[model samples]
Target chain A: MPVNKPFLHGQFAKRGIKAAKGITGIAVLFIAWQIGASVSGVSSYFFPAPVDVYNAFRDMMHKGILEVYLLDSLYRYVVGVFLGSLVGIGVALALGLNKAIAAVFAPLVGFFYAIVESAWLPVFVIWFGYGITTILTLLIFVVAFPILYNVLAGIQTLPIVYVNAARSLGATRWQILREVILPGVLPSIVTGFRIGAGFAFRGLIIAEAIAATSGIGFLIFDGAANKQTDRTIVGMIIMGLLWLIIELAYLRPFERATIQKWGLVTTAEQREVQ
Target chain B: MIVNKELPKISVDNASIAYTNQDFAEPHLAVKDVTLEVSANEFLVVVGPSGCGKSSLLAAIAGFLTPQGGSIKLNGKQIEGPGADRGVVFQDYALLPWKTVLDNVGLGLKFRGMSKAERDKIAREHLALCGLADAEAKYPHQLSGGMRQRAAVARTLANQPEVMLMDEPFAAVDAQTRMTLQEELVRIWQQTEVTVFFVTHSVEEAIFLGDRVMVLSSGPGEIKAMVDIDIERKDRDLSSLNSNPRFQALRDEITRLVRQDAA
Candidate 1:
C-alpha cells in the first residue's frame, strides 16, 4: 500500500465543520482587537490595530523585505533543525545501545540541558561573533539535547518481544536495527522533532534578535527600533501562522503516517482521523 | 511407529543455560546441561513448571540464545545462528500489529526475494490453510486471540521452514479455542511434514500434541523423563483423540512426572 491515501472521506467532512467554527472564533478575536484599539485610541507605537498590522504586512510584501526575511528565517530553521536531529539520533543510539557509552555521556547531556537557551546566548556570541555559524551552532546544541534524550528513552522502552521476534526471524544485528529498532523508535523521534522544532524556532528568533541583519526576528527588532508597532505585530503574527501551517500541512501528516505504519498507535477510532 | 530412514533434524548435547550479571543485577543459571535429539517430521513437546527454562531451551534451539556449554547441530551442521530453515511462533501471538493478515504472512517471503505476486500467492495459500482467507484485510487488533495465533502459525508456515519452534503458542487463548487450535495445528503439521518442538506448562496440551513428551524439572531445568504417546494415529481426527484411553494414560503419566518434580 502507498500508505498516503487521504484519510477516509468522512474525516474531511467532519473537519470542515470544526474548521468553520475555528474561523468564526478567529473572527471574534479580530473584532475584539480592532474595537479595543479604536476605543483606547492608543498611539500606533504602543498598540497597532489589526487593520494597521495588515497594512504593514502589505507594505512590507510590496517592498520585498518580508519575503527576504521570511525566506532567511526558514532556511536557517531547516538547516539547523536537520543538522541537530541527525547528530541527536546518532548520539542517542550510541548511548541507548551501550551502557558504557551512556554512562560517559549522560552526565554531560544533563549538565547542558540544565543551562537555559537565553543564558547560552552571551557565551556563544563571545565565541563565534554574530553570524550564521554562531546562530546555527547554538541552535544545533539547544535543539539536539532533548531529541537525543527522548530518543534514548524511546530505545530503552522498546519491548523485548520485538527484538526476540526479529532475531528469531533470521534478522542479523544490522537487519534488526534497520527493520525493528529504527521503525520502533521512529514515533518517539518524530515526537522529539515536534518538541525540538519548537525550541529551535524560539532559539533562532533569539539569536536573530541579537545577531542577524534580516529575518522575522530582525523584523521585530527593526520595527521596535523605528517605533513601528504595526510591523512588529505583523512579524509576530506571521511567525505564529507559519508554524501553524507547517505543523498542520506537513509535520502532523508525516508523524501520523509513520506512527500508523509502525503499528505503534492502536486506537482504530482515532486512526480514522489520521 | 512408521520411521522413515532420514538424518535427525537437530541434536542437542549437554546444553546448560546460565546468566552472569556484572553491573545490572543478580545472576543465575536457569537450565542445567541437557541432551536430546529431534527427528525430521517428529512432534516433540517439552513441558515443565514455571521458571524451568522451557522457553529458554526453545530459544537456544532457535539460536536466540547461546548455551553456557554443549552444542546444537542441524543435519550434521553446527547451528551458528537463526536461519530461514527454522521459524518460531511466540506465546503472545507476536503478529505485527500494523500489518494486515496478508502482509504479516508475506513478510518472510519479502526477505526471501520473492516477487510480490509470488509472495502474495504463497501467503494466501497459508492464510487459507489456517481458515483466515476472508480475514486477510483485518489487522491484528481486529482479530480474536485464536485468530491471532492462527495468523502467527500461518506466518511461520509461509516461510516454509523445515522446523517449527512454538513456545507456549496456544497458552494465552481460552480452552475452547486452544483445543481447536491444537487440532488444526496437528492437521497442518501432518500435511506440511514440518518438525515441531513445542514448549508448554500444560501436561494435557503436551500429551495431546506430542509423539514424545519431554518433562523438565524446576529452575536449572533438566530432563526428568520422556514419555512416548503411541495412541491411535488418525492424524486428521485429533479432535476425538482426546477421548482415547491411551491418550489419557499418557497424559496421567506426564502429570505424575510434573507433580513428582514439584514435590
Candidate 2:
C-alpha cells in the first residue's frame, strides 16, 4: 500500500497562513514590549522586558527547574485529558443508547454541570489535600462536562434514516452502534473534546497554582512571591509556546485527518437549513 | 406486461399507517386500507401526490415503520422486523459518508457474515453493472449525485434481497440525471430476478420504469388506479419511449388520478 502525505491537498499552504499570522502577532508584541520598557523607565523587577524574560528562561533551563516543571505540568494535564475524555464519551454513549438512562441522569448531570469546577476546588482540596490529586480532579471535571454534552448533542442530531438504512441492511444493535452511531457522532465527539480540552486548560493553570508544588503554574506563583518577576514572565511565555505546539502537533492534524477529510459532518446551522 | 401469478414476494394485507408524533391532537393518517401484492420479478411502481402516504407504505414494507392496522408478509411468513432478505434504497441515497463505494456495496453482505473476499467479488460485479466500474475506491461524496444513487442501488442489490424497496431513490437528482437513472433502473431490473417496489411522485417516471404503475389518492393514500404498461421492455429507451402513444396515455392517466379532488 502507498503511504499518503500527512498534509495533502494544499493543507500546508492553508496552515502556513495561520502560522504566519500567529508568528507575526507574537513578533509585534515582543518588539512593542522592548520599546515600552525603555519608554516607561520601569524597574525590570516589576515587569520584565522580553530579553530579560528570555535570560531568566535560559537561567532556569541551566538549573533544570524549568525542564522538571514542564514535565510535571504536561504529565498531569495529558493524563487528566485522557481519563476525562474516556469517561465522558463512555457515559454519553451509555445514556444516548438508552432513553431510560438519559431521563434518569439528565437533570442530575445538569444540576452538577451548573456548579463550576472552581467551586469544587475547596471541597477537592479537603478530600485530596493540595496535591496532584486535587488538581487532577479539577482538570477532569473541567474537561468531561463539555465532552459529555457534545457527545449527547451529536447523537441526538443524527438523522433517523441512517439508522433505518443500516438496520434494513441486516445490522444488529451492536453493529448499528459500532458502524452507524459511532461514525455518525465522531465529528461531534471530537469537536466536543476540543472545546472541553480548551476549558480544562484554563482550569489546569488555576488548579496547579493552588494545589501542586511543581509545574509552570507553581513557578508563576513562586516567582510572584519571591520577587522573581522575570521568571513569572518566563512561565507565561512557556505556556504560550506549549499551546502553539499542542495545536500544531495534535489538534489541527487530528481534525485534518478525520473531520476535514470526511467533509460530511454539518454544523448545527448547516443541519437546520438542510 | 404479464406479472406471473407465482408466489407473491411481498403481500401487504389491508395495511394502514398514521404519524402520531405530530403536535396536533389528531393522529395524521397516511395510508388507509391499502393492500398490495408484488410477485417475484415484478417491477411495481407506486405513484402519488405530495401528501399521499406512498413513502409510509414503502417504509412499512421495508420494516422501518409498522402499520397501525393489518399485516405485511414476505412469502407467506410474517415480517417480524428488518432482515437481510429485504433491502431498501432511500431518497438521500443513505450511503455511509465514511465508506468508499466498494466498501458500502459490500457492507450489507458483511452483516450477513459473508467472508470479505466473497462479498468484495459480489460488490465489484454489482458496481460494474451499475456503470460504476472504475469508481469503487471513491467515496460517496466524491461521486456525482447520480453516481451516488447508483452506488446505493448496487449496495441494496448486492445483498441479494428477494425484494428491493426504493422510496423516492432518484428524487434528489437533477432532471437530466433522473431520466438517465430511470433508464438505468429499467436495464438493471431486466438483468436481475429481484422484485422491486419503487415509489415516486413523478407520473412519467412511473410509466417509464414500472411494469405496472399503481397510483394512490392525495391523503390517506388509497389505490385510485393500477395501469399495466403494454409497451415492450426494449422500447423503454428515452428516444423511443417519448414517441410511444401507450406510454403517453399511461402518464396522462396517472397524472389525472394523482391530481384528482383538486389536490
Identify the candidate with maximal TM-score.
2
- Per-residue lDDT tens digits of candidate 1, residues B1-263? 56446768988889897665475376667789899999999999999988888888888788877888998877757887678788999999778765688988887887666798999999999999998999888888789999999999998999888899999999899999998999899889989989999999998888778999999998889999988878645632556666777777787888888887674
lDDT of each: 0.85, 0.86
Model 1, position B62, has a per-residue lDDT of 84
The CAPRI classification for model 2 reads as medium
Q: Against the native chain B, what TM-score does each candidate's chain B reach?
A: 0.92, 0.94
Candidate 1 segments exceeding 4 Å error: A1-7, A126-129, A261-263, A266-274, B1-6, B20-24, B112-117, B235-239
Q: What is the C-alpha DockQ of each candidate?
A: 0.44, 0.66
Distance from true location, Cα of A165 in model 1, Å = 1.9
lDDT over C-alpha atoms for residue A41 of model 2: 84
Lowest lDDT block of 10, candidate 2 chain B: B1-10
Highest DockQ among the candidates is held by which one?
2
Q: What are the per-residue Cα lDDT tens digits for candidate 2 across A77-113?
A: 8988888888888888988889999889888889988
| Model 1 lDDT at residue A91 | 90
